[model samples]
Target: MAFRGSLFKFLVVITLYDAFLTVNSQAETTDPTKMTAAILVRVDQSGKGDYTKIQDAIDAVPSNNTELVFVLIKPGIYKEKVTVPADKPFITVSGTKVAETIITWNDSENIFECATFTVLASDFVARYLTIQNTYGNGAQAVALRVSGDRAAFIGCRIISYQDTLLDDTGRHYYSNCYIEGATDFICGNAASVFEKCHLHSVSEGAGAITAQRRESPAEDTGFTFLGCTITGVKTAVLGRPWGPYSRVVFAFSYISSAILPQGWDDWGDSSKQSTVYYGQYKCYGRGAITSKRVGWARSLTSQEASPFLTKDFIGAKDWIRPAPTSFRTASKPISHHSDGNN
Candidate 1:
């Protein structure tokens, strides 16, 4: 009977694995955009791998159903406009090195269409490039806007004064990246996760995280910080409830002295303080003390620390791998930065 039970468990595991693969295979599937622009498109039609501009390669590939266009962006500062439409899926933009490749746009509050790169498509992946809205401490400037259904950022750096990451819709993932912002800069209403990344606050007075305008339970408009570091010079709360049902969690993360003892603010909306789900689990540091934490804030128990807080939490078990590497930590680590960047 023991042997029979063991065999049954093995079969069940196999069945579950197969089911997962099947589900992932169909999730947003792909689009059919190919990179037919040789291996390089030289300004003077020069030699291989030396394109005239990155935009040339981007323009060569046309968006279609099941688009799988891979553009190997060479190292250099690319200053231009990038618009990924809704039907363009599987647009894997990989740079040679994180430090070597940069895409910059200077659009301030007054500048219309102020987005460096806008992703309205689904299942798009970007790696090793620094995307910045070099609007210089202005308002309504967005560095990267993810309006797509499923988007991923790996080994990248996003810098801006305000609205750095505009998560307009769908599920998104950020791993091994650096994101710095001010005010309600990192605001959005999407199911998103920042895994093994760095979140920095630039201004003396600005919020680190924000879940703007999420009034629905079905829309997972929450930000899950998994094994990330939150540090700044000024006193920073975890976040204010931008919407009524706004949700966020810092699981297995590190908090610095820059955070206040209370850890959160009401944003002048007392009713939102009750409905929003804000919590922390297994975080350590000077600001980890929940003794003075807000009444609405939560410290999760071990049982509640399962899929919702683990690597599988926030749906990270979905499509987020490569570039930044997968989340392979058996347990959370203490927060300590070598460069004092944290």
Candidate 2:
């Protein structure tokens, strides 16, 4: 009996040692590259680039994964029709910077069916590129037609005569993006949060934003502008109701002088104003100081802004999406400054 007891103890010890070894082996063998969020694919104007055009590379990727595919395009003018399908989730199209990488094409209001870039995926990210439609803005020139959930645009520029950035579907986020247009140019049907982005008005007459055909107010199909800058000559307002139950909010924004005192235009339809939800929270600059804002416009208190302004509101739920293989650039260490802007 004593010998049997000793043998049992020996087996238990060996099992524990084997378990530890397996775990250590798995951990040690795991590749950091496989865990990368975005795989950088390059695009050059020269035919000698990795991918000749943008859409071809997007097609080459597999749809089974949500791992971000980062197209680190070199400086070039890529004029092509880009459509990001709904199946391709968590794809990131990046360029050097907005000033350098240019993606321009001409599609106008007359061409209602055509959109410069129609995004129909989730977590689609674009950074440091110019998306423009050179159709001269007569009727239906839509530079970017976004219809994705959790889409984020960082330090990008979108330009069109009208309908520059179309928020067609789902919850989206924009940070430091520049969208310029005229006459409902920024209108769309999506719940989007624009942060530190520029909303520029480029034309005269009936210059309004948002024609939101929200399915329901409870679904959050509206625009939330946070700490954005509004510039240009045409008088701007928060937005007009594109459909019944339209909603918009501007929090901590900087408005230019072009804004009207009444804030929003009736769009020749006073009836629609009854359903719209327009609000502003602590705006600065000339267009701000909303003493003359319309009665329909509401001012959000600090409490109301808390949830929307939180980190989770802007895709902080998970900063990184996982992929089988990827490259991760570590966050740079910041030098301590007294100003606390960092």
Tell me the tens digit of each residue's lDDT in model 1 across 1-342. 677767755654454333222212442442222222212222212324434455555544434424244556767788886887775565667786888788898886532367888888776788888999887664778888888866888899988877787877788888888887876666778778788988887768646555465786776567888899888868677788777887888888888887789888888889887788888899988988899999999888877655455545445545544332212211221111222221
Q: Give a tens-digit lDDT track for model 2, residues 1-342.
A: 677767755654454333222222332243322445455556666755556788866765545333446767888888898988887765788887678888888766443456777788776778798998888756788888887766778889988877778787777777788888887777777767888988888767547755656646576567888888888777666577767677777888888887777888666788767777777888898888778888777777888766666435545444433332545321221111223221
lDDT values of the candidates? 0.69, 0.70
TM-score of each: 0.77, 0.79
Count of clashes, each model: 9, 9
